[model samples]
Target: MELSRRGFMKAAGAGVAATSLGAMGFGGAEAAVIAHVRPMKLASTTETRNTCTYCSVACGIIMYSKGDVRKGERAELVHVEGDADHPTNLGTLCPKGAALKDFVRAETRLRQPMHRRPGSDRFEPISWDAALDRIARLMKDDRDANFLASNADGVPVNRWATTGMLAASATTNETAWATFKVAKTLGIVGFDNQARV
Candidate 1:
């Protein structure tokens, strides 16, 4: 007996039919799965609109929360698409920007501050006060020892030591401001950073 295309598929298992349809570049159960998985969902709580932090072009984000803020109720973020109302990113987001929610809401985030003593092999839990105090002391010592208030010919220049301002490019504006303020307080005016002109 000869089998037609539909008869052949019906004889085979649904899985085989699905595979054959895919091979022929046709829609099947797999396509149905993709179509059903919508980006937006009717979450229980309201959404808080925010911006993505991956690049200078901040994209809009909707943070879904289910319960009271203090009680810590269930929250799930659905989509990270760009906000149409945003001036910088008009309803468009790059792959990295779209993955911001995963990064922020990950369980691997540091719960508390940590500190590793000088020449120590590992970081240990420490209070914020202790960590800040240790950092202040280290900064003071380094500034006093390496600070240079003049050029090579000692022309009474206002420049600090080259190693004074240890800056990196990945810092945000708020972080940079705090670091700069601390460095300046220690008379560390020699600024060199990843974003240096």
Candidate 2:
């Protein structure tokens, strides 16, 4: 096949016209997308790298959001998918991880800490600081009230059996170390991890 200058110019012109139209959202390029799907919502949203909180695997996830929440704006979660560049799951999500979007958007999902007073029928949302302070106070009270200083054999066995600590196993080594140190410092005898369950 012999190509002339006129034919080459015509072909190039057609290609340029099609690409320019597609760039302007004309949807004229129906054959296939170039490199990626340019019109998808996933391309327009802000991508966030996160870890799946469902289990001990700690699969890497990509969360796409629409607005800026740091400036006191309303941010909507648009999509959640496994990150291909991650090392844990390698872009594959389990049954629960696959439906993480639904989990996040579920009506019953707890967005804040809720507390129900003694004999109260329902729970009410509270500030994060208040919740943390309440928990710390309760734990301190429990430890002070029921801490065992010594055993029957006159051995110094400092233990707090009434309160327990459950740590997430998916945390990093440093976090796990810190958690263990904190629990041991608190004299917590009933320390467990989520992976064991």
Candidate 3:
């Protein structure tokens, strides 16, 4: 779009000539070349509001998807972009948020929990129940083993130092509060959040 003075004059002269030709009934070719633009893919997709989960900024996002899931159809995500009306980010996204499509479509992306046994060379996907049970068993064992009831000074203290808990950054305020309460109730002393990092 950067037009120098000479380029501008040339463009203007061409415009004049083209208009003069059109006025003389030589406009068929021009009409064919300037046909109406077709509606884009976005116009055919559905829009849904969401929040970016890469961090705690809670940037609003608009998700575009094709296919309706209401009638036994699977919905496929087509695109994602910042929500201009959102107050947090104002239509801007960080590199991670902008590349969420790549994350969603990545070949190595994990859609389920994966577990690898000791000495095993490969990891295998496991059911959500199995994963949760294993995690709870391990955490219970660690807490029972390392939880300190009191310090050397004999002051009462109930703290578990062997395990840590990290909450996702994309949670709502109520979820975060509940997570914090659960961590505290479990005597977790190393609780943190990915967003804070």
lDDT of 2 by residue, 1-197 (tens): 98899999999999999888878767745445554656775776788988898899989999999888887878788888899998888999999988988888899999899999899999999999999999999999999999999999999999999999999987777999999999998899999999888
Give candidate 3's whole-model lDDT. Answer: 0.89
Cand. 1 TM to true fold: 0.53
Q: Model 1, range 1-197, lDDT digits (tens) per residue?
A: 89899987777777887778887758676678778887655455576777675554445655655556566755555545557776666777788877876876789867578987789999899988988898778776776777767778978655446455657544457877888887776566676665553
Clashing pairs in 1: none
For each candidate, how many residue pairs have backbone atoms clashing (under 3 Å)?
A: 0, 0, 0
- What is the lDDT of every predicted structure here? 0.68, 0.89, 0.89
lDDT of 2: 0.89
Which prediction has the highest TM-score against the true structure? 2
Each prediction's TM-score versus the true structure:
0.53, 0.76, 0.72
Candidate 3 lDDT over 89-164, as tens digits, reads 8999999999887777789888899999999999999999999999999998999999998999999799998899
Which segments of model 1 are wrong by more than 4 Å? 1-51, 56-62, 70-79, 152-154, 162-197
Lowest lDDT 10-mer window, candidate 2?
A: 28-37
Q: How would you order the candidates by lDDT, starting with the best? A: 2, 3, 1
**Which residues of candidate 2, in runs, are more than 4 Å off?**
1-40
